[model samples]
Target: MNVSPPPPVGRCLDMCPMRECKEREQQGRLFRFETLVGEGNWARGRCKMRSLPLADPSKTVKEYSRPAAGKKLSSPCDLRPPSVLLKTVNYLLMEVWDHVNERDLASLAEAYIFVFDRLRAVRQDLTVQRIQGRLGAFVLEGSLGFLLCAPYLVRDLPSDSYDEVLHAKQVRDCFADLMECYGMDPKCPREAEFQALLLLYDLGNMDTINRALKLPRGVGDSPQVQIALAVNRAYLEGNWVRLFRLVHQLDCLQACSFYRHLPNARDNALRVLTHAYSSRNCRFPLDLLVVLLAIDTTGMASEMCRRRGLAVISGEKQSVVFFKASFKDSGPECAGREYILIETKRGDFTWAEIMMGENEGEFMRPKTN
Candidate 1:
């Protein structure tokens, strides 16, 4: 009969720290490779639980705004016991996955928010810690969901459309919940990814990112870490080309949604760059601006500037000038001059207040591109 060699003596025996404990160590002449058990023989004792599966993260945040099957989500987890809320959430998440895959962000938000609202609506003096844990996870899911939905939020919608404003508020509410729950005591597996996404969203806020990631300034060398850092480096150094490339090429890193938001992101960045120029000298080379905006023509740049109330002065050599702030000139053309200063708030809302609901006041706003 063929015999397989005894799985080579466990290499961990020498490195095992448990050998020092007399009570915990195996009762043998010399600490054997595999004789210890229980609290004493930690090194020799095999892992009790099965190995976890690999992290194949799915659904871009925007993708989760929709629910699966277009069918109303019926949280099957709402069984007799209140503890079954966890199961209900898991079921809703499954529905969330189905919706995101369908590219229906609206339905996705509704289902998750529905579940979250129900949990919050509960009036009992809840003693179960499991419910709290589920709430945290749900909040995380909603927060990430809005981060991806941010691009859509940035676009201008009809003010009269109640549906548009409602969606925006829903996105804001989720974002608020996310911020409130972000720095809690218990860490979740997806927290790292959420932090990475937040870094990508607010490229201008390096200090916040540094504190959040706990990394030395300008020192993200680990390839195993999320790719948001890579994008972060590019954006900070004004490497727009590389930043765009990284956005499109990181599906495996769970940033495929970044690619979807690329156009809006570029628009937002260009708008910021234009906004940064002093009112006195707003002129910039049209060709250079085109290259920086990653657009094909100066006409497009001029059109965008006009929409934002910036005067695009054309020069003989295809040079264009952008006015960062609208000048208060009394003329038929400059009638709406002051309103031009009402730049988008870019999703301004207090997280503490969001958690407080109406008690937080009515100044809630959604995040912009």
Candidate 2:
């Protein structure tokens, strides 16, 4: 006798013969993938199967739709221990970030992207796993240090580079996240430093400086905080000499964070100086400009002067001849060299040492002759 055809597969787990039936004798077959109802084709839903009797293949298949009670899913990253996550963050800061340089802009950008992604992953893990106490604080501090270095790395890159804006925005957003972390813990010793960095990051914004001033009594008194306030005040007053002087006092990371403001500050200073030293025959020593603008070399200072339509006379001492009428307002050009202050200070400590707060007092002290 002819047998009736088997029933068409339905949405229920038991209705689909393709699914492995748990009730059947162990065949060790793998479960087939299935798309659940209302979920698009791309959505995956796993199911435990039950077999029906061979005598009746047409019966409606039983549903095993609900997930097992009390079962939970977690990402592998979320499962990592606090120590492991902290180590990963430290690795990125100490090892991976050390080699990121400006030799190849494309490669530099790629390296930054890679390191930033890993750091972000670790940070997310710390948050999701609810890591707290000293370990969490250390990890957060390390991540903040990494964020603070972003501007220094990209400082020399041409502003028109395709990834420039993307890099800037990402760094700002990540910095804000780190600040929020410290904001939750008022007593963290590093919190004052990060708050000061926020002020330095936007020196032109009076609101940021004002908010910083209103912090708990002692925060405004911290060395970094005092320096950041001074820098902001000097910037508002067009006092480039005092501004760069205060910048020289900042620690390596804080100076790096403040580098972004250099171009605007320099531009504004040169504009004001144009009118102040207006005589066509009056000569301003390029060496003095170097000191005033915190420029690394007189050559770079001369080039910046030339760009702004000043006349440079070369001899025993290079000097710029300022004529208010000839001074071209060429907005702000990135003219300064890599911060020698950071380079010299960085040479004294390894990235690991910096992260550990080793010799912190010496590190933060203004370099003296």
**Best by the lDDT measure:** 2
User: Roughly what TM-score does model 2 have, to 2 decimal places?
Assistant: 0.69
All predictions: root-mean-square deviation over Cα? 22.3, 16.0
Q: Compose the digit string of candidate 2's lDDT tens values, residues 1-369.
A: 999653232122222122223332134222111122211422223233633222111211112222357842233322346566565665565555554555788766655665665566555555555555555666767766766666566555655543656556656665555656556666777777777878888777977877888888778788878888898999888888788888888877777678778788888888888888889788898899888877779878898899988999998998988888888878887534565657665765654345434424643344456
lDDT of 1: 0.40
Residue 355 displacement (Å), model 1: 22
Model 1: per-residue lDDT, tens digit, 131-230? 2343554444533443354324323323332244454454444444454554443444445545555565555476745665674223333332347777
Clashes of each: 12, 0
State TM-scores per candidate. Answer: 0.38, 0.69
Q: What lDDT is reached at residue 155 by model 1? A: 32
Worst 10 residues of 2 by lDDT: 55-64
C-alpha displacement of 180 in model 2, angstroms? 3.2
Candidate 1's displacement at residue 127, Å, is: 11
Candidate 1 RMSD computed on C-alpha atoms after optimal superposition onto the true structure: 22.3
